[model samples]
Target: MKTPFALAAMTALLLPAALPARSAADPVFTAAAMRAHVEFLADDLLQGRDTGSEGHEIAARYVASQFDGLGLKPAGDAGGWLQRIAFQQTERTNIPAVLTLTGPAGDKSWTHGTDVIVGLNPDEPKVDLSAPLVFVGYGIENARMGLNDYAGLDVKGKIVVTLRGYPKGLPSEEGAHLSATKAKVAEAHGAVGMLSVATLQSMKARPWARMLTFANEPDFTWVDTDGQAHVDAPGIRAAASVNEPVVAALFAGAPQSIAAIRKQADKPGGKPRGFALKGSARIQVESVGKRVASPNVVGILPGSDPVLQREYVVLSAHLDHIGISEAKPDDKPDTDRINNGALDNAAGIATLLEVARAMALSPEKPRRSIIFLASTGEEKGLLGADYFARHPAVPVRQIVGNVDLDMPLLLYPFTDVIAFGANHSTLGPIVANAVAPMTIKLSPDPMPQEGIFVRSDHYMFVKQGVPAVFLATGFANGGEKAWGDFLGGAYHHPGDDMNQKIDWNAGARFAEANYRITRALADSDAAPLWYQADFFGDTFAPNAKKAAH
Candidate 1:
């Protein structure tokens, strides 16, 4: 167990008299009731709470019960506390996947699990297609950014050879979003498939061998009411990432050399132009899948104000984790294989529960209604939260703001916090004021290149035109080293159990910070609005009211 910070007593500042006082030996974490929640949720018996598993169902029931005990109204389906979601989980069936390129020189082929690896296709069980190839730099088409890789190119009824990542030197979050959804642009142009050849930079980050290992992981997408799986660009029949050899072949005898394209992509503000290649590509793969179901626990705390009560501020935390590893006789007898995910997010859920308790016990009710959500399938590409955002328990337009709690590192005393996406909306000052009284500062995004803004549950809400922020303990005071150490070792591993060094006082402080932020959003006179002319605001909610930056 890690020792509490020197200023551990400051935990009492959280909710400021929300819970009973605790002795010096027993801190506010226990008094605030997070310790019990964390211990139970992160216990070995929960089996890591894998999405759609029995363990996860148990975890969901526990969260529902906690909400029920708080006297909160059920906000889920059919007057119940569970918003059930169906998913289509898929994995490759070890078929001999193959990709062929026919060019001026000759026909060249590469087998999967080696020079190429195809991603799982949730829409098709088996795919066989051949289409002409076109090289599109970064495959990003955004008119607002004044840089469209497909500006002068037509990929209709053909396969497009694209770079793996976004161009250099765009706004980190906006660039990341454009790059991530590049497939949709390809579909819009009637492209039949995507042929992604990694840049030298991307290959350095994820080498061929490492990419091969990750390619084996299963893929998931939520199912619609019609029993069809969701795909961002369903029109794109297939996509495959190729290595150096395939990249060379894709650009052979082209107007622009691959080496020059690589050089341009290696530097800042690289914009390699797109062109038609000499040849066509054929892609083939087989996918095996099964239908699975999970639930998002939803509870409503009614607002006191008659008018504002119709509006809502959502507080969400993901409850599922990576599952356990299979036991092998070759494994060491002392080896513990369960990935309990104590900090990977059992801690976040615990904090959410405590925040709920603090709100329920507080004498004053919020002006706007509050929804406390324990979402499942977050580890599976934010599936649960995405489902909820698209199909909310309440009207999606009624959600004015969202504060998502994901992976708060309670390893050290954080002197500051980071609210991702705060700068894009009026929520910035609200977050700032909430933590100021606790002697905590608000910091800017320290690692912008990681594109963390679009990688959490709140991003799902943001896409639905809701102003949202993902709150996490910042890298300050011993937090930098603590974050690095945990990420390098325990993150997503068996070492993330309760056995690790977890400072309860830090957890309490983190919970309090989120509580204050939620209370402020719910009580504020005006709903959170995107800053004027913001990219996300214009793109997602173009006609909505906006705030001055």
Candidate 2:
């Protein structure tokens, strides 16, 4: 007997044929067209379209040309198709950045990549610090939740060591924000430096090797109007992720062991207490900074309704990917060297283009304008999207919602999609309504532990109070295993190129689902709204209208 999921998969598999055929009036999103876009963007000639690279510029122009050909109006910086984002790229110098510990036992120096990974401070050419260490639990301080990890602990002029995650009970969004901005919190608490240690679960999810793979990759910050990179609140002089072993070593003379702390942090409602460690840390950092310009391609489709046309819905996909690997396999010289981010993002951009084309060529226009944004610097901490969100081509308040197309792993006959950030706003029901006609299942996030909601380009919009959802192929019809295999093998590798197998039909279906969602948002009488009393709404956009039933 086939399971319910299997039956759903079968039903979905039969959908393409059973659905009405596309006519000249309604443009069909074809796999061949999407593949064409992907092939060009992910070509080796584009050198993986790294942010601020020449290949990236070429890809930006190509997207602009496609948007122009589709008859979409240019909506970017200074009445152009490209929004230039200023970035300050910083790299760590070869000069050995060191972390030394001093205790009753003796002084010991830990290796950079092995026992610790230090983040380069671009503002400071060198950071030399020697301060007492304080264990600050998960390093989260949320006043809304009445949770302050720094409470009862004074870290002034001290090096605060903390775990990576927040308590399990806090809302995912709240916890994610706290965890992400812990560095700033530490700075506010008058800490001179910070040392982060991963829990067992975090280590297993992202191994140290994977974390160190891009150690040399340049870190970027959006440049301010004064032509200066935005700086954090003053106080933190140095920060690094210390190895678990190093963490255990730091607690050598303490009453509680590092293992005990990890055990407590893993439990529900668990709050590890902060304590002063016997040891003090000395950290040294050296950095080199350079500036570059990256362009985000933008195009706008006007709406039929004059009033609704003033409101805009955004469709976004990142155009950048990790470029060529610095470390090449000497034995496999014949192998491809470029990290052609096919599914990582080229597929996403292709999907965006197809959707834009469909909307532009349709006989009926949406009620609200749709903005297609192909962003850059997503690989560099979502910088492009951040800049756009901060300085939008359209009035920021007029932006209604965002539908982000990132890596939709279309390796199998997917029957469902995982829409990150769907639950927070009316966009959830909108997405359900959009996909109901197509008979596609909408799944909750399968791997919430990875924090998929806040990691992508859509997050920038979300931060600015715009409701957003990022669609990805979900765990159905062997998609779980296929997605895992892709991540384990080809993700960010040279193998993520055209050589990998692709299910064109799946790609087409993915695009179709996104187009429907975008159309629904654009045509809806009421704009997308945050759920009343939602954490994100209360925190980011308290004045946002409540969703209409």
TM accuracy, model 2: 0.94
lDDT of 1 by residue, 1-549 (tens): 755775466664655688766544321335236667888988989899999888899999999999999999998889999999999989888677799999977899998878888877888899998999999899988788877888889899999989988877888899888888988999998999998888877777678897886677788889988888999999999999998888888888999999999999989889899999999999998889999999999999999999999999999999999888667789998788888888879889998998888777677888899999999999999999999999998899999999999999988878999999989999989999988988999999988877899999999999999999999999989988998899889998899988877888888888888888999999999999999999999989998999988
**Which runs in model 1 stand beyond 4 Å of their true positions?**
1-32, 326-330
Clashing pairs in 1: none
Cα lDDT for residue 400, candidate 2:
93
Query: What lDDT score is found at residue 235 in candidate 1?
Result: 93
User: For model 2, which pairs clash?
Assistant: none
lDDT of 2 at 548: 42
lDDT of each: 0.89, 0.87
